[model samples]
Structures are given as structure tokens and as C-alpha cells.
Target: MVPHQCLGSVWSRRNRPGNEHVAPTVRATIAQFNVVASCIITTCLGDPSMTAQDRAVVVGHWIRVAKACQILGNYSSLRAILEALQSVSIHCLQRTWDNVSRKSF
Candidate 1:
């Protein structure tokens, strides 16, 4: 096991913007993150009666979210985006500062 943190290592995508690859990566990251976050956050915010398996599922789900957020963007409002990201519990998905996600698109 890579400690669940290695998956969040930022992938350096070069020339992606010029090739229109950036948009899809961003969109995919957001979409995937949203989906995984929904599952994990829902179970997490739900009853304390959740089983150990449910908690494990949430932990794995958050790892997916972290990996998605690891896909970086080179837009102008990076600072604002980062701040906004901090507002969400998804920030814990990465378990480290391995990703620099934006709050604002």
C-alpha cells in the first residue's frame, strides 16, 4: 500500500492546454471528485451507527477524490480556487498537500 497518499502525487501534464487536454482533465477531476465525495461525505455525515466496512469504503472513496484533485490546472485564479477548496472537507481527501486544487473554476 502506498499509504493512500502516493495516489495524490501531482501529474505534470505538459502541452495539454495547447492540445485541449486540460479541460477534460479538469472536468474529469471535478466530476470524479464530486462523485466520490458524495459517497464518502454522505456516509461520514450520516449516523454514527455506520459499520466499520462503511468507514473503510469512505476512506477509499476519499482517496479517489484526492487523486482527482491531484490533476492540476494552470488558470489565473489559482489562489481563490485553493481557498475555496479549503472550504470543503474534500481537502482531507488527499491527506497531504500533494495537490493544489482551485475552489473557483
Candidate 2:
């Protein structure tokens, strides 16, 4: 999905009310999850004017971060990073992808 659409869906769910049955901790956890996911997508695609090489560098940085998250057993952040990288907005940047090093993948 496109980054903006994904973020909008998450935002809607996060703000939806009338779920008193759900524990406060659970609600907070879900909110945190959504926020992390949204942030990851935004950070990856927020700057439209960035050069292809700069975008590639950002992509590489995220890849390394995902690897660290995996090693540390931070599945939530890892999933968010993966989703952001795979999102249509970032995936369609052919020039950026071309500039990304093989090691990043």
C-alpha cells in the first residue's frame, strides 16, 4: 500500500473510541505499534526532493536498523521497517533502488 494510506488507516484505528472493554495497556501498546509503523514510513518517504542517492542512503540506514532490530528481538520495529521498505511509495523509486548497494538488501 501507499505510505499515506497505510498511515491514515493506522491513525483512524488509533483514535477510534468506545472500546472500554479493552485494557488500557493493550490500547496503549496498539497505539505505540501504529505510531512506530507510521513513523517508519514517513521517515523513509517524507522528503520528496531528496536525490536518488540520498534516498538510497536512507534505505540502507533503515536496512541496517532492521537487522539490529532482528538481532535484538525487536519484532515490532523490524516489521515496521520491513513494511516501510516494501510500501509502494518507496518500492516504486526505481532510481533510488538502483543506487542502493547490494549489501543493504
Candidate 3:
């Protein structure tokens, strides 16, 4: 999935084939999961072995989680997403944008 648009797509996919438990408790669990997931992604992005494309993939996953939490109607989760997004380096955002800007596939 595309980096910037990853979340919306993930949410849409989840809406179609979601776990029954994943939906109802999603609102309640989203905030904590978002933070944990964001931290993990942030750490992954910082791995010295990861390439630019790999970093972009990690950022895309964070975007997906953010989108999912937002669509779940969890305000705390949304806040966490905002914080995570801020924590993401500007270079990462630019890389995501660059990836998007050049897509012809």
C-alpha cells in the first residue's frame, strides 16, 4: 500500500474482513496499541540495517495503524497517532512523499 494513504486502505480492508473481537474492543484498546506500535515502528526505522525503502515501509505501517485507530472512533488513539506522526522524522515524511510522487504503477 502507498505510504500516506496506507491507513485508509487498511481501515477499509479491516472493515471488510475484520475479526469480530478486533472491531468491538478496537476503540478501547486502540490508544495503547497505537503507542506500542508507534514505538516499535520508530525503533524499526532507526535500525542501521534498514534502507530508505525499509524506513518508508515502517512509516507506512504507522500510518496504517493511525488510520485504523482514527476510523475506530477512538480519540485517544487519534491523539497517539498525531504524536507518533510528529515523532516521525521530517526526512521520513519527505521520503514517503517522494515515493508517492514518483508512482506510476
Candidate 4:
């Protein structure tokens, strides 16, 4: 089965009637999504020790990973990664963003 279809099936199962409690699979999926997003944001901004250039490199790496996710039809991951990159903390890093290559934009 396609990746999205598999995820959709798992997600749909969670919303079915009489499923009073959340399924473990669904919960795990949600957690994984949140983790991916959080990790991206943290990697970009969590370390005060990282230089602007270093942060820019990390941002570029995540962007490339997001593009790969898009190509693989993993919209859930792509959305999470994009949202992280656009989060307030990461978005406000002017120096880091300036260090990012124009080609990356």
C-alpha cells in the first residue's frame, strides 16, 4: 500500500464510532509528528552555542529532508517540517537566515 494510504487507514481507524479510547497506533503517530516538528525547531534554535552559519547549515539540511519527504509523498512529514521551519523561534533568526544561501530560498 502507498505510504499515505497506510497512514490514512490508521488515522481513520481512530475516528471510527465506539472507539472510546484513542488507539495506541494513532497516539504514536501523533507523537511522532510532534517530535519531528519539535526536533526541527530545536535543531535550528535550541543550541545557543551554534554559530549563525552552523544554524543555517542545519536549516538547509532540514529543507532538503522536507523536499525528499515531498517527493516520497509524505505530506504529513513535509507539513511538520515546514511548520517547524516557519515557527516563531526559527523564523526570527535573521542572522541564521541571512547565512542561508539564496539558492536555498
Candidate 5:
């Protein structure tokens, strides 16, 4: 998602109660799960062309997003993000994961 558009839209939706411009809670949860899963698969395994260093960078970005979700009290997104991080596909990349700092785990 584009940074300004997605975040700006979510912020705007927070002000209006009746308008259905955004997704409902369940749909949002499913969407978040799908997004995180896609990120995990693509970043960790899908791109044979992408360097391990590049994938690690993408994973780090997701970790930051997860932390932001936690701080915002968005547990569903946080849970989905965490599950993506914990997936076996990501874990299978030992070299990529080794680049992650010990404190991050």
C-alpha cells in the first residue's frame, strides 16, 4: 500500500462512524493476514532473484510494522504480522535470519 494513501485513509475513517469507506473488522483481519503471509512468502522464498540481504531488510520492515500495530492497540494486525514472522518459510532461511540481530528475536 502507498504510505500516504493507506494511512491517510485509515486516519480519515477513524473520524467517521457511519460511512463504510473502509473494510469491516473481520475483512480487515483477513486482509491483514493475507498481506503478512504474502510478504513472508515473497520476501523469504518467492524471489530467487532477491538477495538474502534484501529479504532480511523486508522482514525487518514488517517487524517495525508489527511493533507499530502493537503500539496502536491493533491486536489483530499485530497477531497476523507476528504469525507471518514465525512462519516456517521464513525460518527456513537460516542465512537470511542469521543477519537479524539477536535482540530482534
Candidate 6:
């Protein structure tokens, strides 16, 4: 038998009826994270005139999104967004980040 079928059979045996809701919740959470990740990367990379303050604001917004992902138990999205933020940091204006509050970091 195929591995997929084997796994499904095992999963079905252990699964409860009401747990069917998990798939849709997971799908929606992933979709939301995808959009958020796209927006964060685009906003940071596309704008050359972005000030340090601007960068801090962007990072702050992403931090909030990451927190939401954590609360929702969506590790995939949280990791993706955090990585994207780290990737974009190399391009960020240093002086602006210095001025930002520590809590945002």
C-alpha cells in the first residue's frame, strides 16, 4: 500500500470527528502568513527612500504579526516571517534602528 494511504488510515483511526476543523484552520493560517510575508518583504525591498524610522516601523509591524502567529500556534509562518525580517535587516538603515525602542526588537 502507498505511504499516503497508510498514514491516512492511521490518522483516521486516531482522529476525532470534531478535529476535522483543524485542516481548514491550518490552511487559513498559512494563507494569512503568506500574504503577510509577501507584504513585509516587498515593502522593505522596494523602497530605497525608507528611513531608519520607517524601517523600524516596518519591523515593529512584522514583530506584531510574528507574535500573532506564535499565539495561533503557526510555527511555519512565524519562522518564515522572522527569517524574512532577518534577511531584510542587512539593507536597513542603521541610524534609524538605533533610534527605535528596544521593545520593538
Query: By lDDT, who's the top model here?
Result: 4
What is the lDDT of every predicted structure here? 0.45, 0.77, 0.56, 0.85, 0.72, 0.69
Local error of candidate 5 at residue 16 (angstroms): 36
Predicted candidate 6 versus true structure: per-residue lDDT over 1-87, tens digit per residue: 234434555546435776654445444655776786777788765688887778777777778888998999978788878877766
- Residue 51, candidate 2: C-alpha displacement in angstroms: 0.9
Candidate 5 residue-wise lDDT at 71: 95
Better TM-score candidate (3, 4): 4
The best candidate by TM-score is 4
What is the per-residue lDDT of model 5 for residues 47-89, given as tens digits with 9 covering 90 to 100? 7887778778777777887888899998877887788778887
lDDT of 4 by residue, 2-44 (tens): 3553466555766678753545655766788899999999888
Writing each residue's lDDT as its tens digit, candidate 3 over 1-105 gives 234333554445444554433334444456575766467546655577776567666656656766777788876765765666566563455655455323211
TM-score of each: 0.29, 0.73, 0.47, 0.74, 0.62, 0.56
Ranking by lDDT: 4, 2, 5, 6, 3, 1
Model 4's TM-score against the true structure: 0.74
Q: Model 4: clashing residue pairs?
A: none
The positional error of residue 93 in candidate 1, measured at the CA in angstroms, is 15
For model 6 the TM-score comes to 0.56
- Poorest 10 consecutive residues of model 5 by lDDT? 1-10
Report how far residue 87 has shifted in candidate 3, in Å: 2.6
Query: Where is model 1 poorest over a 10-residue stretch in terms of lDDT?
Result: 1-10
Ranking by TM-score: 4, 2, 5, 6, 3, 1
Off by over 4 Å in 2: 1-17
Backbone clashes (count) for model 6: 1
* lDDT, candidate 1, 1-105, per-residue tens: 123222333234423466444345555555655664454555554666755555445545444454555565533233333433454654554532333223311
Q: How far is candidate 5 from the true structure (C-alpha RMSD, Å)?
A: 9.5
